[model samples]
Target: MAYQLRGGGGVAPDLNPLPPEGGEQAPPPAAEVDRISSLPEKARLRILSFLPLKAAVKLGMVSNRWSHLVNTPQWPCDSILAIHIRPATQGPCGCLVPTHIRSDQIMPLLANELGRRGRGPGHRLLRFFLKVDDAQTRPADFYSLLDYAADCDVEDFYVDAGLGPPEVSFNFQRASHRLLRLVLFGVGVNQAHRRPMSQERSINTLEVITIENTSLGDLELKWVLLLCPRLRTLVLRNCRVLTCVDVTAASERLVRLTVAECPQVDKISVSAALGLHSFRYIGDLLRSVALPPTCFGDLRICFTKATLVDPIQYHNWLDALPNLSNLVNLTICSNALKIMSALRNRENFQTQVAKLSNLQNLRELRLVLYRMNTLMLSHTYGFLRMCRCSRLRNLFLELPKARTDSFVDAVNGLAEEPAMDGFESLVKVKINNFQWQCIEIELVHFLFRKARSLQKLILVAPKGTNPERDQSGNAIFPDLNLLCLEKAPANVEVQGAQLVLWL
Candidate 1:
């Protein structure tokens, strides 16, 4: 979820207005300009807090009193790093925040400021954000801030710096102990700088860290592993530039780790499963990846391509997780079926998906087959025969391009197996992005007959190129408690109950 702006709906906070000081100052408009200084104290603080860290401090010119408040320990501080822009045909209306602090200014400010105010409840600030606005951030500025944060025992450092090639490349050993959260977005560091980061943290002091599109070498990551002993949450996205990650700490306190869009992470050996319970790995090539025998509990993996070199490699990787038999929720997606048709690997590969039948604690399963030959879904019934999950109840499948006959055969095969049952207990089934093929309708009919325990069925309408090309229709669902159809009429009670319709 995107963080809501302080004012909601990403609306910017209001700022104080000022009259021009130069001789070129133009005449004022008829309406009065309400300056921030005129606002009440609490309101004024809120307004300043809403301002990006850079702009907030530049407002020292608002008044000397305001300058003191800007540096007060009660307020929040962030790096003025990010920049966003929007344009119009007429012109551009942009919001630019520039910071002017350098190493010299920040050092004294910390030594003097913390000396007077001190830490504790009085120092209990909400969050510390690192801005990356180029307006006034110099390379030296961050080094000083890094050192200052180390000395001050700062925690919760949030960084969004588009730093110069090597703006900040130091480590935090002792001083970084109190740090809890580290959020890095588009923040790059000098990987060549193998210089040891003297800063090493405790076994579990690090609570959570998020990184996106940032390039950090394995050495640096391993450095963090040694320092951040008590890592609870780690999220890495689009960091495919990294090929090696030392997850040696997976055996202790780490609870959740999510990695996505990292194409380079082919081998994931969880040597030390730690306190890990939730693990999600989604990337380009999942076939070659490895998972340790320790990884267990809630796990999710997705693949839209069949480029998996060895299909069984993934199953072997899954087997490595100790508690695989007890997975609560499992989701598998493959969009490569279309490409697989030409290769003839579909028949052999079907066994790979069925191998997931061993997940005993699996209660909910969502399978998405994108633009792949949906007919291959028939192979899933064999999986049903192998599955021993008695608690399975909810099933959701998305076959946007599945051939109609294949869909029908899949359901029919499942129903034919008497011992392979979920009929009376299965409550929900959803099929999205339906193709208008005849087999698609047949599949729906087959589901109505096979799923006696089904309470709800949803058929999502296929998209139309233009609004004019859309079709208006409703689908029949006999013996079902609820049916949801798209691009149809209202909730007309056709038979037993009114099926929900969306246009």
Candidate 2:
């Protein structure tokens, strides 16, 4: 959305009236001057609409011709209608609104604006946005304002009624008449709205809906899905309302669903009817998720905790991973890497392999851990040896502070078995939370030696303030202190936080 101004060639010469005494000494004819005003009213209004509301209003005050077009009901400009009213800080226009600008002052302003533009004959509203920051604002005024917006036939509505107690719920059925997309922040939906969703209502036009910081239970959510058949994308953030998300109704269009930071949800069940192509959840590890026996394009799940002592929990996770083998990109984060470390002896190597072998179709793997050490490295080696990530191109590992010697030894151990064919397909590798140490050079050296298809390697060298750079300004990493350092592979490249290099 870029806004640029193109000059109208040059301002038309202003025509001044000639004195009565002058016969032929007349200024330019009025027809030759003020070309913009001479344009049709609709054209002028369209031009004014391109300017911001503040600028358009200011221009109306200055130009009499424009004022008629702007103030009159015949104005053809489809201006973006948005209202921002807050008693504190600033008004919707970001103007310095006084602290005393109470609901009385703001409500009437909103009501009058909506009533005039929205209630006018042949009014067509393309979009509508309202944000109220004052918590003390009257509920009656707010609801009334929404009623006016509905009258305007708004297609997209975004509202953020200020934070309040759980008892304060705003009915959504009022605006569901023509809404295509609805986003609500810090507002709850009324119970009356729930029944309408279950019954056939005018909410079929809704294609996208997002709710955040609101309390809505599983039943209300099920109704939302059942009500809006055309819904394609649904997002619920930090909304702890449902213990389970069971979408067995098989919504054909609901393809993308994301539920994040919802601590209350423990189980998620989806049917083939939803045709979900992408699903993501970020919560505790103990929670269970059920997906259809079909492949999804992307599946990203984050576990809050992965304990080592719980073999039952590990077994549960093991059972879940195979069902999601159709995932193209997989991200797993937990102290569960600790479980890998705990199982790192010769006796448990095959067992560790059996657990992760379900990841057959994975192309990108992101492993986040609480710490990085020899034990974690051995577990990583076990994972790479056992899991079939043959298509894996990008590998991201988040490591904590650990000994450099152990880190290098782990890389060496993984690279020793080239027949494992784990890093053979690896192209890009990024290791975060890394400290620049002498042993890190050997780690990079071994990776560059084994991963023949490697193209780019990024390492976060936190301690090194100065790293050598090539003529192209790419960082010369693995800051080897040795006089004779191993030569990097020809096809590989190294980059630090500052530069990019191709060898």
The clash numbers for all candidates, in the given order, read 28, 0
Candidate that scores best on lDDT: 2
Which candidate gets the maximum TM-score versus the true structure? 2
* Candidate 2 lDDT, 1-503, residue by residue in tens: 11222464234333454445756554547665556677776667667645544455677798898787655444443544666656655545544322224555766665564455556324545456667767767777777666766766666677776452234555556663656778878777667643554364547778788888878788777766766778888888878776777766435777888888888887777655347877877776546666655567677666665445563454444444435466677666645545544444436454533645666677888887665544455555556666667778888876655543443454444423324466668888877655543333444666687688988776654444344542235454545442132344555553334222334
lDDT of 1 at 391: 70
Q: Each model's C-alpha lDDT? A: 0.53, 0.61
**Per-prediction TM-score, please?**
0.58, 0.64
Q: Per-residue lDDT for 310-408 in model 1, tens only?
A: 554344443444546667776666533322332224565444444455666677877666543334444344345456566777777776543434434
Error of 1 at 219 (Å): 1.0
